[model samples]
Target chain A: MSIFVDGNTTIVLQGATGSEGSFWAQHMIEMGARVVAAVTPGKEGQKLHGVPVFHSVRRAHAQHAAKAAMLFVPPRFARDAVLEALDAGIPRVVTIADGIPLHDQIQIRAAARAEGAQVVGGNTSGVISPGKSMVGMFPYWIERVYRPGSIGVMTRSGSLTNEVTAWVVDAGFGVSTLVGVGGDLVPGSRFAEFLPAFETDPETQAVVIVGELGGTMEEEVAEAIRDGVFTKPVVAFLGGRTAPSGKRMGHAGAIATGSSGTVAGKVKELEGAGALVADRPCRVGELLARVVQ
Target chain B: MRLLEYQGKAVFKEAGIMVPAARVVRASENQALRDEACAAARELMSAAGIGRQAEQDPTGSSGGETAWFAPGVMVKAQVTSGGRGKAGLIVRAESPEDAGQAAVAIVEREPSVRVILLEQMVDSACELYLSISTDAGSARHLILASAVGGVEIETLAEQNPTAIQRVSVDPFMGLQPYQTRGLGYDLGFSGELVKRFAQVTSSLYQVFRANDTELAEINPLFVTQDGSLIAGDSKLIIDDNSLNRQPQFEVTREQYGTDTEYEAALEGIPYVQFDGDISLMCAGAGLTTTVYDLVQFEGGTVANYLEFGGPNYRKARRAMELCLKNRSSVILIVTFGTIARADVMAEGIVGAIAELKPDRPIVTCIRGTNEEAATETLADAGIEPLLDTEEAVRRAVAIAKGEQV
Candidate 1:
């Protein structure tokens, strides 16, 4: 069983009339995800890839029962779109937009908590449950990377996530659910937030995390591991060790702002908590191979 | 973009926050402009009623200009990099000539110096620190305040942790008056001082929100002898993503120079030059850092780093052109499309290659969203794409190292 989405998950695609939105909507459909409806305000009646489209989430919810919503809206409108998804009782939302204002993300995070909903990203690549359902825009065309395995993958970096998943696949394992929590400073979910679900998923024998410099999310994950909140074997690959101290690297959250965001600080904390940490992405599969055994 | 001290103070003034009276003395390589800047500093000091007395008696044996500083005015060099006070860039002048001389010395030392500010020095009982910045861990705006100021907050944080009082403002509720009062109390303020502190805190938040500021800091929020709070110094960093809403802040990028990353930023590209041989371009910060690490691990040197400029093909093409212009030993473009489409990115790279055609080996790892079409497009330009991320890096490193891939 997958953690976030699966074969039974009926998803609604927001901003579905846009190029990226419609394209991903079609791709999701091809991956066997039930794309029940699409939403674009001006083109409500227009159908994309044979899926019905509505102007509002409320209108779409009234006609079709959807368990999840994937927002392909622009950054400026991401906050309202996530709030709309939450208000419409779509329990899970995955936003693909990047560069949302920090204030907007803060409000979105608060609203999500109040509604008891999970919003994956404002800058994320979306989530994928291999061989089950892909709500995100993963490179499903190369189906070799994800073969429905027992390792759960959660990462802040999108591109690096691809590299790690490729390693996992090559090591004779597959992902139960790979969630991109985004590389932004204020992502909806932290590394610790997903560990519980990974622990509870019987299909997930181990969890692999791809973290980077900046933020204390990795340190929080270490706390979770030490406290026994996550019982599964965990292997982590922390990037940006070679990056200059003051430079932002690539992610807005990937800079060493204080003593906590340093790569050494994160690695020391995770290793201190008994989580095997890999210095490089190529080392992750090797470390996990030993840990999961 | 980070604004200079004078520019930050201008923003603070616009937000109704009180700042010291100051004037900017613009500098240049030309001696005439340099002289004019010094003259401008002299005029500023004269207007503040400090430099006139020193002009009359340069020796100051007759108790002129208080022997050291020009009674009230301070010459502050404007530079983006910090520690100016410790760097001896900031100078206190006792005369208009001294002020001008200070400006000239600073301008001569730092070519990046565009302007020097002469500010009316505030008489203060004590210095306080305050800043409003987003805390990623808590996912909220953090209001950091300390009674101790005029020194680096990092040093203060290291020495006395409890002296710093932090209050996380709920984005929904914002910074309420009661909460500010509690913080003010924690900082040893009460009654009217508490109300004033709360007002300043609220106004600073307004400035931060209205300007789409990533960070707004008043390092030395001075408490004057008369119990009034004045913003002694400030630093403001605008979120580049919010530039659409903040049109006035557009000029902040113009202040950037050739020595800095401004050239790439102007083209809407994220490029950071490194001392290496291989040119690397990719999407996402995580991937960029990982690629850099991987190249290093494989014993390859990266001359430059470029990120695909958002989802726009034009910006991506510009980013490619910039990397191609770097003249590195080999160029590697490893991109994984998620929010961005592989086809669009391929179009960008192909367009750049057809136009620029740097006589160097280029390797690209194209994945996600219409991968076949993207690969075909790259192949049409006589460039073969690597499907695997690891193999692509290995190939690029191998080529950079002058080995067969």
Candidate 2:
């Protein structure tokens, strides 16, 4: 069984009439995810790819029992959209908007936490249980990189996730579940939230983390591994080693301002916690190959 | 989007927060700047209501006694970089003569310093620290207050961790009056002082929300002799995404000048400069960091970190121009386009190469989304694509080290 989404996951789509929303809705459908309902406030009663569109998450849930949601709303509208999703009792949501204000993210995370639900990202590419049910902007047309297997891949980078997954797929292993947690300063789901799920999933034999400099998320991953919350063999890679101090590298969260967010510091902590950390993305596959056996 | 001290203070004043009456002495290479500095010193004295005829007391024997500049004035170096006090850029000037000298000395030391701030120094009874910052771990805006102040908060967090009180504010409810009062009480304030402190805290939060500030801090919030609270120094960092709404705060990039930063701002590319040799370019921030780390891991240094979003070739070209202008030893292009099309990135690189025709070695790696088209485009431009990350990194390092391809 995959961690978050799988064959039986009935998903509701938010902002479904937008160009990006329409494209991904069709893509998810093509990947065999049951796109049960679509939510577009103004475009209700319309159909996208033969999928019925409702005006709100509540209206859509009334018609079809959608347990999970995928949000393609813009950054400005993301907070309201996610609140609507949580209000409708959708337990899991994946928000794909980037550049969402920090205050809005805090509210979204708080609301999700209060309801015992999970919001994947405000700047994320989304999550996939590969070959089962895919939600996000992940390029489903490139199927070889994401063939279902036993390795759980979670990363802060979207394209790098695909890059590392390509290496894993080429090395004769496939991703059981891959989650792009986003590179926002305050991503909705931290590595700690997903690591435990991978550890308990029977189909997943190993976990690969592609982390970056900035924030204490990587350090938290180390703490969890050290605390024995996650007992699975974990391989990790962190970027921004060559980054100069005090300069933000595009991502709002990728700047290393203090000792807690340094690459060298994170590497030492992760390695100290019994996780084999890779120096390069390709080496992650080699490390995972050795550990999984 | 980190504003200069003056810019930050301007936003603070707009929010009705109290700050020192100050004037900025703009830096210049000619007589205009010299004239400006003299005028700035006179302005500082007049703003403090201290006449030029006031006697200069050099000894500073009685700290409580009024000096030449009545309330006294502080000339602080306005560099974007922090730790100015430790850098010896901050000086207390009691006279116009001292203020003028201080500004000139600071400008001489820091070539990048465009302005010097001369503020009316307050005789504070106590220095308390207060800040509203977004803590990623908590996923919320946190209010941090401490009776201890005048030192870097990070330093305080390390040495006396218990001195700081951190409270998470719910964005839905905003920062409540009770929460503010609780923090004031935590800082050992009582009676009207606590209420006054809470008012300042509440106003700071409003400033943070109103201006879309990522960080709003009043280091050393002063408790004057009369028990009134005023912000001694303020820092407000506006969110880059929210800059469109803050047109008044937009000129800060030019005010806080850096060659690469100005160039990046002009090009609409997120570029950060370093003193390394190789120029590294990538599509996304995460992968750019990956390439950066790998380059350093392989014993190479990066000249700059440049990332392109979407299919914008103009940004790519401008990035290439910046690298060449910096005279990097080599240029390494790592493209793993997800939403960004590889073909578009390749076309941009090809366009850059055709126009610039750099003498330095150029190496590239491409993968995902239209890889064939990207490969064909690069090949047509007489450049081979290196798809392996490890191998490409090694080659880039070798070339950077002056090795022949």
lDDT of each: 0.79, 0.81
* lDDT tens per residue, model 1, B1-405: 678888888888777677766777677556765566557656665555663332222332221222222355678877777788888789877666677677778767776677788876666788899999987656678989999988777778888888999999887777788888899999999777787788788889998888888889998998755456778888898876677777787654435644436767766666787778888878767887888888887788888878873454346556766776665888888876655678888888888877877788889898765778899999988898888766888898888888876
lDDT of 1: 0.79
Clashing pairs in 1: A149-A174, B70-B93, B70-B94
| Model 1 Cα shift for residue B269 (angstroms) | 1.4
| CAPRI docking class of candidate 2 | medium
Candidate that scores best on TM-score: 2
Q: Candidate 2 has which clashing residue pairs, if any?
A: none
The CAPRI-style docking tier of model 1 reads: medium
Give the residue spans of candidate 1 off by over 4 A.
A42-46, B51-72, B251-254, B298-301, B312-316, B324-329, B339-347, B359-405
Cα distance off (Å), candidate 1, residue A252:
1.7
Candidate 1, residue B263: CA error in Å?
3.0
DockQ of 2: 0.65
